[model samples]
Target: MMACAGGQPGTDAERPVLFSVVTEPIVCCPNDPDDAKTLSDVAGAKIDEVFIGSCMTNIGHFRAASKLLEGKKDMPVKLWMAPPTKMDAKQLTEEGHYGVFGAAGARMEMPGCSLCMGNQAQVKEGATVMSTSTRNFPNRLGRGLLVFSAISDGTQS
Candidate 1:
């Protein structure tokens, strides 16, 4: 990577080659409030699976997720948590945050780029996922649209 010093940085050699093109928008959700939405329409929406992992989320995010999972029994959401680093997983496990996820029937994966790349773990087709990754590119998690969520002010998780 070159540092931009007043002028533009990358040369023709630095540019990446294109593969397949995506004509559709990365996120497919409707902007209209009249349509279904997050935390409400998606809540108890009978998602086929769920994945929660990324460098974007820290211990606080996991805690917030646990807060939301609290008191909810018989959850049909197939939850997965794959922290970006081993230390993050360790800390969460130490602080009992992982237990919260475990109690909620969420599986914990070894810290790495698991579902983010559709590599290590993959969600089923026709599933809806809420993630914490910066990009919601098509199939970034799996074969479904991704919603990037963070615990906002006065929000649960």
Candidate 2:
């Protein structure tokens, strides 16, 4: 999880910090390369959705996803990437990172809490979602929505 500027808790007077949270590979994890062996091992799996934009998902996330999808164009994962701010989105797009994600069959969205907030677009009931946002609680985004923090680079979750 790459923590970018924006989405920090504070007012305009507060300073922002950039950091990333990575986690070690857990045994029996579905996305674990040691267990899966190939992208097809997880392709077309039951994934409710994927939220790729947030303080946890920076350019590194895009690059990782791109590499994962390399030579596996038919991956079956519904991906929605939302940069923490419009500026991040613009810079990423300008740098051609957006194309990398798109080539991997991921959709790019505007910067905002599109799914993290129950009021915004809500996740389907009992749907399994992977996100880069912090916190995972009942009805935090929607009732019974299973939200998992995406671990990137086999270090951050």
Candidate 3:
């Protein structure tokens, strides 16, 4: 299983339940993590913005994103990138990932909780966003935002 969950020990739901058998990467729909679907499910869907950051993401994720965006310029959607820490940002800069992000017209956010907590940066109102944030509850990031949460590779940011 790609994801799993279980209740507390000595309770009625002690055994872990298989959450999903994801053969490939999956993404959660807006406002509902349980409403998971494969990337193909959202094919041809309009994405107004893309966010590849927050606490849930790691250096590897950013590296993968950079690799995908290598030599690309003028991204179709508004792309936001933020590493989990200043150290990650530094490493990506040293590795030239920052240049890739810039070439793609991605907005480089501060290294920490950029758009995940709804505190630092926020997407456009009523925008459809593909994100790596941990959650996609209503109004968490912005008013009337439709946030689809997924791993970096799944979203292909």
Best by lDDT: 3
Report lDDT (Cα) of residue 80, candidate 2.
75
On TM-score, the candidate that comes out on top is 3
Tens digit per residue, CA lDDT, model 1, 1-157: 2222222346542333231342322222322212222354344444556667776666667777878987666777788888889988888889788878877888888898887677887777657665555555666666655444322222223
In angstroms, give how far residue 127 of model 3 lies from its true place. 0.2
- TM values, all candidates: 0.61, 0.59, 0.83
Measured by TM-score, how close is model 3 to the native structure?
0.83
Report backbone clashes per prediction: 0, 6, 0
Q: Which sections of candidate 2 miss by over 4 Å?
A: 1-23, 26-46, 70-72, 151-157
For residue 44, model 1's alpha carbon misses the true position, in angstroms, by 8.8
Stretches of candidate 1 exceeding 4 Å from the true structure: 1-46, 144-157
**Candidate 3 C-alpha lDDT tens digits along 27-73:** 88887765676789877778999988887788888898889999998
Q: For residues 1-157, what per-residue lDDT tens digits would candidate 2 score against the true structure?
A: 2322223346553333223332232111222212211234434556767777656566666666666765555456577777777777787779777777777777676677666565556667777776666545566656776566544443332
Query: On a 0 to 100 scale, what is the lDDT of residue 7 in model 1?
Result: 23
Model 2 weakest lDDT span, ten residues long: 27-36
The candidate with the higher lDDT, 1 or 3, is: 3
